[model samples]
Target: MYKVTVYVTYKDSVLDPQGEAVKGAVHRMGYDSVENIRIGKYFEIQVSKDEDDIEQVIEEICDKLLANVVMETYRYDIQEVEI
Candidate 1:
């Protein structure tokens, strides 16, 4: 089996309003040291070992469904799993 961990986030050029709001809240709560924050999505996927071209599959999934290519970017890590 294979385990895939996907992280999707806004591109650096885009503004993250949610993250900014959270940071503002944190600052109000007396956390002045908090400099910046960015919100992102995490996905864990499991694939059978029988699948061919796991990397390609993951790339397509991310590009087509998980992330918006214009505003967001994604990265993934693949690990072999015993179960």
Candidate 2:
């Protein structure tokens, strides 16, 4: 079996309103030290070892469903597990 951890985030050129809002709230709460904040998504996927190419599978899924390639970017980490 394989375990995949995916992280999806807005592109650097894209504005992150949610992250901005949270940063504002943090400032109000007296945490001025914060420079900025970026909101993102995380996904965990499990695949059978029978999948000949785990990396390829993960990349396709991330491109199609896990992220919006135009405005967002994605990265993933994979680990093999004992069946």
Candidate 3:
């Protein structure tokens, strides 16, 4: 079995409204040392196949369907798991 983890986030040039809101809230709570913040998404997938090309297939899926390349950046890691 293999486990895949994906992280998706807005590009640096893009504005993150949710992150900004959280930052403002933190400041209102008397946390003045806080700096800029950014929000991201994470996904976990499990592939039952034992093929060697599974990683490649998962990458293709991330590029094509799972993530949007225009405004977001995505990275993934795959690891073999013991049953």
Q: Which parts of model 2 are misplaced by more than 4 Å?
A: none
Give the CA lDDT, 0 to 100, for residue 65 in model 1: 98
Across residues 1-83, which tens digit of lDDT does each residue of candidate 2 receive?
99999999999999999999999999999999999999999999999989998999999999899999999999999999997
Model 1: worst 10 consecutive residues (lDDT sum): 74-83
Q: If both were scored by TM-score, which would come out higher, candidate 2 or candidate 3? A: 2
Cα-based lDDT at residue 75, candidate 1:
97
What is candidate 3's lDDT per residue for 19-46, written digit by digit as tens?
9999999999999999998999999989
TM-score of 3: 0.88
Which 10 residues in a row give candidate 2 its minimum summed lDDT?
74-83
Error (Å) of candidate 3 at residue 66 is: 2.0
Query: On residues 41-74, what C-alpha lDDT tens digit does candidate 1 reach at each position?
Result: 9999999999999999999999999999999999
**Candidate 2: deviation at residue 69, Å?**
0.2
RMSD of each: 0.5, 0.7, 1.3
Q: Alpha carbon lDDT of residue 75, candidate 2? A: 92
lDDT of each: 0.98, 0.96, 0.89
Candidate 2 Cα RMSD after full superposition onto the native fold (Å): 0.7
Better of 1 and 2 by lDDT: 1
lDDT ranking, high to low: 1, 2, 3
